[model samples]
Target chain A: MDNVASLMHGFSVALTTHHILLMMAGVLLGILVGVLPGLGAPNGVSLLLPLTFSMDPVSAIILLTSLYWGALFGGSTTSILFNIPGEPSSVATTFDGHPMAKQGRATEALSFAFLSAGFGAMAGVILITLLSGWVAKFALKFSSPEYFAVYFMTFASFIGLGGASPLKAIVSMGVGFALASIGMDSVSGNVRLTFEFDALLGGVSFLIAVIGLFGIGELIITMEEGLKFEGVQAKVRISDVLRTAAKLPRYWVALLRSSLIGIWMGITPGGPTAASFMSYAMAKRTSRNPAKFGKGEPEGVIAPETADHAAGSSAMLPMLALGIPGSATAAVMMGGLMIWGLNPGPTLFTDRPDFVWGLIASMYLGNVVAVIVVLATVPLFASILRIPFAIIGPIIVAICFIGAFTVASKSFDIWLALAFGVVGYLFKKLDYPIAPLVLAMVIGDKAEDAFRQSMIFSQGSLSIFWSNALVSTLMAIGVVLLLLPLVGMIAQRLRGRTAQSTV
Target chain B: MITRFWAESATAVATMAFGLIIVYGALEFGIGWDSSGPQPGAFPFYTGLLVALASLGTLALTIGRRIAGNAGLQESFLDAERFKRVASFFLPLLAFVVLSVTLGMYVATILYLVFAMRFQGGYGWLPSLATAFGAAAFFYLALEKFFQIGLLKGPLEPLLGL
Candidate 1:
């Protein structure tokens, strides 16, 4: 009941005229950012972060979160119209969305995609509002050891559960840790890795790293691919949208199932991309007419879109309640929170109830606004796909350079962005998992502080991690997750041997 | 010139080398435990060690595959046509960075835009130049006037004297 009351209070805060305008502008820009290749949610947020430095924390968060919702919708538009996934999570949407567009059902597919996304986001927000208090209360008991264990679990899961090779993931994470260890150590106040260079003293900013890695790095790869933006043409209609929306009740099972999958993945570290893929696979396996899945099926569009938005929205829950982000974009948003002088985790709920609830309230309004804006302006956003890549590419690079410099108003960061761009380009080429590296970069300092705090508490005794059941259980999970790949490899080898012997 | 396998192998070796350097650096900061508990170097020392070990593991995997004749060494990093395309825009980007440093963001942006659009985009000189000027003017108004953020400026600012 208190939670519901708090959410209602949040609605009062969110429904202010200024806040609504900010949300509207944010969603519009977010769609533009998403439609543009090489500029994603993280990059968009990073680029705009410097501008929000002077704004109130509540408004800043509303704008960014609304933009996030808009980007999700925008990515879907490109997927349906161009077969080009504007966001990584929308990859599965293209598998069937483009096919639907091909069959002259683009309006139906577009309507289904946005409506499902709206539904999924609503479900995710409801779950977060219901579960956050309990989760916060549980997390309030965590000590430094347990905190360190959680961070370790995140890194370990990236290694164990990543699509890339485990060794490659470790290498990426290791590099991130090394980069994070530079600049001034917050606890000891001692400089490490600067080698007396003036620019290295403040350390490498995660914002700069993110801008370089995702923004500039993606530009290089797109340039390499010789990007072409010409896409399929379609006209959306109100009647068609209504007709398709009227049919949405039949897939209640899929909508609910995908929302559940998305919520689970969002809370965990699997993220939206994984959730969408998992939901689509589950939908395909369970559907009666699996053969029709890739041939422009409405369920195909709904399952992934629903799960993607659900996961994207719900990923914020962990960040708000636990100070841990479930995805890279969430990590950047958490960084923004830290910049606004707000601490995430249990303290966030206790200290800043207004901001928390306000953000939650805006999520509800933002998605509704996103659906309306995207539907009304599909042709305008879709036409962006027709712009020549050559013109778009250089401009993106310019934005990245300017964005990096604005982070600290330093010329040194422009060079840093260039260096990391090369690193990002190479990492992509080598099939290295970049997400773990980015996540590690953002969280490394906090994790290191937690480790050192635990050490100080235990007088250098590592066994302190196992002294309590909570910390010990978390540590055990971390270790198991880290070793899961090895165990799987060995089991596979054994199975292969047995099969050969039987043969 | 390097094959994909060798390139990855080199990356692993470089990682290992970096780890060794970190370990040496951490030693100077003192990794020893004391009454105050672990020292500053303790965590970094171990982190470096972990990095070194994992990188070695990657290197080992690459080598093992090579010995088994399954390393796929014949695959080059980038084919000829792809390399040509990447260099087209990449070289201009490098120029744009240097030019921005010397010529301010606005002028540098205009020049780069015209060049990229004309050469890479195959646009006519008039359209390319007009679009470049339009974008530069918009950015100046939006970023500088509205947002009140000062980007890099060069000698051209005083000449306009706005």
Candidate 2:
């Protein structure tokens, strides 16, 4: 098909020395940020977006996208060695991974997680390459209602996950919506919060806010907690990865299921966190040995690592096909796309088939390259955690400060970074989930724009949200999903009542 | 004091208070100028209204849970030291804001970085000063020179004469 020829063209662009270098830089930085506790991939991508201004669109995307892949691989290392998850997706990995480390089987766990992540990521990329065109064509049929439904589903997933207190999650999300409103309303053209400042006229920079909230916030919280890594290092032999393959078939089902879930969630914009959580929950509930699930089960590690990678990889589909980002990191990638002066959507694919196909082909190559590099270097990175947190803490904070300033080249971002670092620390202290905050910050405005535009189309009627068959169907699903926590509560209450009646 | 009920309760009140203040702020600015062109107040006014509604709901939830004697809010959200640390960061941050408005981004950054690293983070003169200067220098060169983004013309901009 034409797809194969286009992929060949993509490889030609991706193989260029500059593109390869950019990919390498992105992957290296991504891994480093993922290994750190506070600064996740989204923050890391945002912090460095300013650098993309000078680069071609392909280079910008290669760098950021590689980082997304790198962070997925990187989060596993800390979870395996230190029992600390580098990002939310790695939380499941920690359950079994840390236990395996304590049992002197750290190498086995680490290798298992890495190989699965790499393999799953490769699978996701291949699927995206094959199916992105179809997905984009379908997306092109979407109107305002469908777009708003997509946003609603994505937002509701974050709030309805039952991770944080519902109120806190909603409040944090509301806070994001509020921050998003600070800018000039694209739909309404109102300047709500700028207060006459020209800088405010441009609206709050999502990039800047992300850096402050994730990057700087992490540093401040780390300083408060007192940076320290207390863990025993296992013998990280190079052969562990090779040895782990023998065990791969045992986790084959988890690998496949999580990868499927991840791919579905990612392309649908259900998000990496939801994908990881769903895969882990399903894996645990369905596992033969449910008792082994949470307390360091290998399946736990397999499921989430697989899902995170798949989600990270497939997230590219939306950017390539529809010009919409499925997640925050993808949004940042979209920014890079804009910087490259290469528009993303359906028309671009037709016009610049080389750019489109080359990217897809390059992703396949990049996946292979990333897996090999990560596996070979996992031991070296596991050793970095051995660095004292006191020192690491200061260095991270310094990097964050630099990252923030670089975002706008404005001192305002630096202050905002510190402010967010403090806010992050506060959020952590309160046990409020911070991911929703970050997610909300990234998508809040887009969701608002969709909502307001839909409103205007209906001339300010709420019925439009449910007027369309697809939108109504999606909204019904959303309502059911929102009731999940309440259903759990009811089930628990019924169980108690049954026991009381038995008495 | 660390009870979930109180925390939720207090947060509810704070939320309601903040929402009211925000709504009042919007009203003060003249809400929703729905001109043929986009108005400055429309988005904010709606947002302010939403905040007000959400907070009131939060308050109702808080009260309902408390009256029902549900103690499920046992998880302590904030640590004592967190507030103190927030104060430490916030002061320097506030200073950076004030300075940036007056002296522009580059100059304000130098002062914020030094103060934050040295005093706020409790680093010493050499390391903190060096860290701040190094960061600012790169930012100035990378953005101002490479990207062609002009910096605020403080004492330095006039001498360089563009």
Candidate 3:
């Protein structure tokens, strides 16, 4: 009860006039960004980092995190109304969503998606509020060994749960960690990797890496496919969606199931796409009418849409709670947190209780705003699908270049941005999962420091990892996560061999 | 798809070599004098090791799977026609980066818009030129005049220094 009241105090700060205005602006801007190709919630948040430097920590976090939530919501609009998935998380929506639009069920599909997404996101926020206290207590008990072990498991699991082969994910992460070590060393204060290049002195900037891997990479891939929009031409109205004319209560099972799928993926760092695909698969298998899936089935659309939104929104959990980002956008938000001079962790819930909880409260507020704004304006953004990609192409490029230059107000950063654009193109061509690289770079340094500091604190004792009960438990879980895939493969092979022998 | 996977896998293998060189290079300056905190090489060395090990494992596993009769990597998410359109405009975008630093953002943008619209977009010259100038003007006003951002003005700006 006391805790709830204290959280209410946090709400007072979050609901201030200035804070409210910033949240509004963030939500609006995030939607615009989400609608645009090549710009996700993360990129928009990063591009806006400079603007937050002068603001108080609470408002800064509010602005960035709200922008993040809003962008995730914004992404689904394009995915459902048109065939375009504005963010990666919304990809599954195109499977059934666009088809539903073509069949003139856009109103129902759109409304279901929005309502369930809001419900899912609201659920995620509550989970954060209730679970954060317990999670933080567990996190606070971690020493350096436990911290290193946690980082290890998270990075390793990128291979485990990231839709790629375990080996490829691991390689990508390892390379990222190496790249992270390129500048001056943090602990010993020595020049480790620069090779005497002055530009390398600052090490790789998170801005540079993200712009290259995602923004630029997408730009290249965008070129390969060229610009085309086969968006649905539907006459969807607000009332049609708001009416709840369709009795989808039976599908509530799908919606809830998908939401759980999303929240699990988000928390485990599997990301939105994972949630989308998993929920889509689960919804199909569980459906009484499986054949209807992928053929404009509203179930297909609703399942992935609800799950993606849930995953995208719930991924915020890890980012705020443990300072470990569950998705690229969340990773970018982490940078925004650093820029605002507020580090996220257990301390975030304590010292900056208002900042953390306020951000949570703002999630509720921003989600309502996003639902209203998006539902009202879906037709307008969907109309953008009609614009020729040729026209939209130049506009996106202009935004990318301009946003890149703003990072340093220097010509050099502009050049770096262009260079990254090429690298981005290459990564896309090669089929490399860009997220692991980006995510690893974001946390590589911290993870390394955590490992070394633990060692130093333990006088080079490797056994400290097992000395603490919490650390031991987490490490055991991490080891299981790492080995589970291999074990599964072995079990499958054995089953196959035994069946053949019996035959 | 299997072949393409190997091709990319090879590239990553090469990248690992580059990464190894970087790790070694960073440690050359004695990897920091051992201090109360941590030796400088300590972190970099471990990161480098992880990269080498991970990349090596990735290449090996990918190859191993191929040899084990894994026929092909499964379906790709890319849409071909959509990809083609983005590429044409994308090439010129790289060119725009070079032009911006040399010629200036405004003039470079004008050129980029013209190229993008005419070639990639298949738009008429009049609309293309109109778009080029209009875009430049809007950006100039939004970033420079309204935001008061002092962009590295073009040759034209020097003449019309307001």
Candidate 4:
């Protein structure tokens, strides 16, 4: 009942004309960013972040989150039409989406993708509404040890379940932590890692890193591939859209199962990309005609799209409630929260219910707006891909450098962005996961603060982590998650030895 | 041509050097914990150490794989054709950055767009010029006029000012 009342109040706060207009504009810009290659959800959000510096927190968040919803939908547009995924999460959509387009069922495939994605996003929002209150209240009892434990669990899960090599993951994460620890240390007021350079006073900005890595880095790869958008021209008819929407309820089972998978992954650290891939795999395994999966199957289009949007929306919960982002885009948003003079944690709910609940209510409204807007504007966005990459590519590069310059208006950041661009390209090519690095940079200082605070409480005794049951349980889970991969590898090797002996 | 083994090994070495640099910088501050708690350098010291050690592990793994005659590691990381494409794109981007600092961003934006669209893309001169000028104007109006943010400016803007 309390949650419902709070939601109603949130609706009132978010229902103004100003907020709705922002949602529409955000979704439109988001779709543009999504339609273009090399500009993803994270890069798009960061690009718009500087523009939002002057707005109120609620309006800012509403715009950013709406753009995210729009970007997810836009990513699917490219997948179905051009056989290229605009966003990493939409790669699975290409399997059946392009096939459907090739079969002249582009309208049906697109309608199914959009409708099911809306459904998944709604399910995720509902879950957030129901659980946010409990999570916030539970987190209010947390101390430094518990906070550190939460961060530990996040990083540990990323390593154990990230599917990246453990050594590379550690190096990536360590570099992030080291970069974050530059400049003045708040606890002791000592400048660490400056190397006597005056520009090191502010440390490396994560925004610069993001632009260089995801923006310029991605552009370089696209150039190397010599990408051309020879796409199927989608002629969407209202009747076809209506027919597809009508048939959507027939796949209620897949929708429900995928929503569960998406929500689970979103709350954990599997993120939207992982969630989409996993949901696609699950749908294939459970289908009666699994062989029809990559062959213009509607279920194939529906599964990954639903899971992608669901995970994208639900991942906001941990970022809002616990100050831990579940994805790179969410990490950028959390960085935005800090810049807005708002600390993301349990206190945010009590201190500013209007901001928290208003943002949540806006999520419900944003997805509805996204689905409708995307449905009406599919051809418009698809045509954007028809524009030559030569023109679009340089423009994107300019936007990236301009964005880097706007972050505190530093020329040094432009150089820094270029450096990170090279690093980003190398890292991507080498299969070193970039999410852990971004996540580490975002929370690195906070994790250090929590650890140092806990150490003070325990007088540097490491046993403080296990002093309380809550903290101990959190630490125990972290340890298990950290060791799970190693255990699996060892077990596999042992099984291989046994099989060899039997042979 | 570069093989995957060399690329992996070089990257490992670079990361290891980065980690060691951090470690050296961290040593300037006391890495030891005191009664007051952790020193300023303690956190970075450990993180740097972790990075260095993990990078060494990666290096070792790469060497072991190479020793085992891994076919995948022997594949070309970048062939000549791919290198040419990447270089053409990267060199202009490098020029754009240098111009952005010395010249203004707006000027660099126009020049870079023109070069890419006209010379590289083989578009007509009219369209390339239109796009180049249009992008600069749009950015100027949107960023400078609307957003009230000043971008990097050079000698040209001052002479043309009212």
Off by over 4 Å in 4: none
Q: Please provide, for model 2 over A1-503, each residue's C-alpha lDDT reduced to its tens digit, 9 standing for 90 to 100.
A: 65676677788888988778777777777888898876788888886677777766666667777887788778888888888888877887888888988888888888888888887788788888788877777777767677778666665665576466666666666666666667566654555666566666655666776777776666666655555676658665777767777879977888899999999888766677778888989998998889987676888888888898898888888767866666768876675666567766776787777777767776776766677667767767777888555335544555566566666666566566666666665565565556555555555665666666776678767798799787898777777766776787799999999999999
Error of 1 at A266 (Å): 0.9
All candidates in order of TM-score, best leading: 4, 1, 3, 2
* Tens digit per residue, CA lDDT, model 1, B1-162: 558887788878988887777777777777887666667777778778888998899899888888888847558877787788778877888898888888877788899999999987899999999989998888889888998998888789779984
lDDT at residue A390 of model 1 (Cα atoms): 76
Query: Which 10 consecutive residues of model 3 chain A have the lowest summed lDDT?
Result: A241-250
What C-alpha lDDT values do all the predictions have?
A: 0.87, 0.71, 0.74, 0.93
What are the models' TM-scores?
Answer: 0.97, 0.84, 0.92, 0.99
True-vs-predicted CA distance for residue A325, candidate 4, Å: 0.5
* Model 3, span A283-342: residue lDDT tens: 999988899887788888778877887877788888877888888878877767876777
Note the DockQ of each predicted structure: 0.67, 0.25, 0.54, 0.87
Locate the minimum summed-lDDT window of 10 residues in model 1 chain A.
Answer: A226-235
Worst lDDT 10-window in candidate 3 chain B: B73-82
Q: Could you give the C-alpha RMSD of every candidate to the true structure, in order shown?
A: 1.6, 4.2, 3.1, 1.0
Docking class of 4: high
Residues A336-432, candidate 1: write the lDDT tens digits: 9988999999988889999999999998898898889889989998887787777778888888888988898877888898888877888877878
Is model 1 an incorrect, acceptable, medium or high docking prediction?
Answer: medium
TM-score of 4: 0.99
B49-162: candidate 4 lDDT, tens digit per residue: 999999999999999999998899999888999999999999999999999999888889999999999999999999999999999999999988898788888777888791
DockQ comparison, 1 vs 2, better candidate: 1
- lDDT over C-alpha atoms for residue A492 of model 4: 100
For residues B32-129, what per-residue lDDT tens digits would candidate 3 score against the true structure?
43556456676666666666776787677667876786755333434465445554556687788888878778888889988888976789999999
All candidates in order of lDDT, best leading: 4, 1, 3, 2
